[model samples]
Target: MKSPKASSVTIALILLLITGWLLWSSAAAAEETPYIRGAALIDTHGCLACHSGNLMGAMKVPPLRGCELPEEEFQAWVLYGCPQAQPGRAQQSRFGMPAYEGHLDPEDVQDILAWSQIAGHEVPDQAALSDLARGEQVALKAGCFDCHGPLGQGGIKNTGSFTGAIPGFSGEQFKHLCDDGDPAAIEEWIRHGTSERFLSGEPLAGLGRSFMSSQLTKMPAYQDILSDEEIELLVRYCLHINSLGPMSAERYEAHRAALASSKMEVTGQEDSLAGPSLPREVAELFSSKCIRCHGPKKQKSDYRMDTAAAAFQSGDIADFLEVSVIQPGAPRESLLYQFVSATEEDSLNEVFPMPPSEDERLSPEELKVIRDWIASGAPWSDKQTLQSAYSD
Candidate 1:
């Protein structure tokens, strides 16, 4: 028989092995949480405060929800800066959230997206199952592709020539877009349906040629074609496919710092505030939809919708800002407008069309008010009218 000390040592070794095995098993299970789970973890981390799930960005924070980007491209986005996020400036690290590098593992990032389909949310398992294709077919049937490109990639650049609309995605890609959740912008696109939509803040309009305002002719209402849920799911898929680039931690930090400096710089130099000319109805609209993102200087999205004048020239408005799946003027029609206008119960998109998948869209009266404003050419009323209308 073995000595008592040897027996004790052997027993200890067996217990240690068991403990190690259990830990390894647990880690494996955690790692396998999948894309949706990983995304949920991110949600739990409070990323939604700044980064939306719908990929529709706000003034301060851009969208990140169902962004459709490849892993390599997405990795770069997470790590570097480009026109998609910003040029020269770093990734945004100052937007009410923490840097995810130390807090999340790369595998965890993958899992967040994998588990994204829970709660019956749409998550396409195959690339062939693209809602963009379906949307493209609809766009073609609607004569949207005549200028917008084969996929809704063509858009108008600032120089007055037509260019490609923003890219589209396979079904799986839509998930990332919804995760960012900039539904207000989405609603604006749907309601206003104009080339001047996103122009108030962006500069890309400078590179384009012809605009597509004439294409705003009536077509089959989306309500007649796709279910609201189907349309929203498509939107989410597009964002996920488009946002497949990596996020750069270093660039994000740099941009965060720059944003801080830009704020300081603007504050010290500005003493000559412009005289107010905003109307009451428009003013109320601004207060409700424009202020949260654009009120402060160094406005988010590089565009400020706060003042009609400031936003009027911003290229992204006309070119396309975050919001509707379709860029306003091109082959891309504002689905936001289409879904919000629906009067039937089945009209509700996968989620409500505004605020977010997590939030409610405007009431019918409010939507009708906005729709009327857009239909009447969306003139910028003066401050007096705006104040009088919204004061109650």
Candidate 2:
């Protein structure tokens, strides 16, 4: 009944309203909230007391913050609690978070997730710049690569041959098999149980025990250090690896080209004073040279020169030795340095100079780097820094 001009104007008004509403809804959804609310809620419920303020579950409790639990599994855990809560049992769940169903509503669970996400405590962001590198480190620390091949490419499958059995899966083939597989499924298998589908009926005798026995069985349970979300991110990393396969060659080419172009930029940066300062270089040198012999390998003569990990393992790097060496924060107190730097009389007397006679002494530059690095808090830099810088 309205004139054409009037109808067009009405339609325009309706479209404008729709657009405005959509924008507003999107902005609201994207809004950032303070992590304090979530942190407080966790604290309010005594969850922090058991789970720790950071939500890194206690000794008896599995880590919850970084877990990759699927929504349904998470729901099941909260609602029913674990079917078996006793220790030393095969149990319905590997961890003990005590089902929250009767005590906390579904809304409460959602709020918990929301709180966790805000605190940068939830499963780490898949889009995070460090996700892949961090995931790789987790995989290594967890020994995922021992069975799954480097970079989760999976292990070689053998069908048998005139030359016995050969590694059946190349890195590419392994990537293909694991692509897009549910992280939750892997977690379920790891935590709950695994199937026989791994290597099928292949009789790989020389390969030693099957993947099932070698890995799923032997690997130490990490319900302590890792969380559900972290596992999810790892699975996501598996997918990312698979995705890289189809275009891997092209990507490699592009990478090479970029490296070629950036050579000057890279060289310039390395020359810049901002390059890994003295302390880092020194720490790295120590890790490479001294740690191998004096540290964990033998701790020869009770002198373990291993990384800070050694010190962390013993709490007092001094206790393992006949005398105290490091004062932490202050390298001046670190006897390890003085021993290495010992000029005849300063040597730990009867204690053989580290690395002994056969082993090489630290290069002058190496020693300086080690000294500086030790004094600088012994920071272990991200893995890719040195490699990427030189590659560029």
- TM for every model, in the order presented, reads 0.21, 0.23
Model 1, 190: alpha-carbon shift in Å? 38
Worst 10 residues of 1 by lDDT: 167-176
Off by over 4 Å in 2: 1-280, 295-297, 303-307, 312-317, 320-324, 347-351, 381-392
lDDT of each: 0.39, 0.44
- For every model shown, the clashing-pair count is 136, 16
Once superposed on the true structure, which residue ranges of model 1 sit more than 4 Å away at CA?
1-279, 313-353, 357-360, 381-392
lDDT of 1 by residue, 131-154 (tens): 433433344454433332222222
| Winning candidate number (TM-score) | 2
Please give, for residues 1-392, the per-residue lDDT of candidate 2 as tens digits.
Answer: 89999999999999999998787455322111222233345666667566554544335654456435655565566555653222233233345555555566665665555444322222223343344445655666776655444443332232322212111112333332223254544454344334233333235433333434543224345555678767765665555444333212222222223222222322455544432222445545555555554543455545554444344232233454535464323344456665566555445453345545545666677666555544433343232122111111
Model 2 vs. true fold: TM: 0.23
To one decimal, what is the Cα RMSD in angstroms of model 2 from the true structure?
26.1
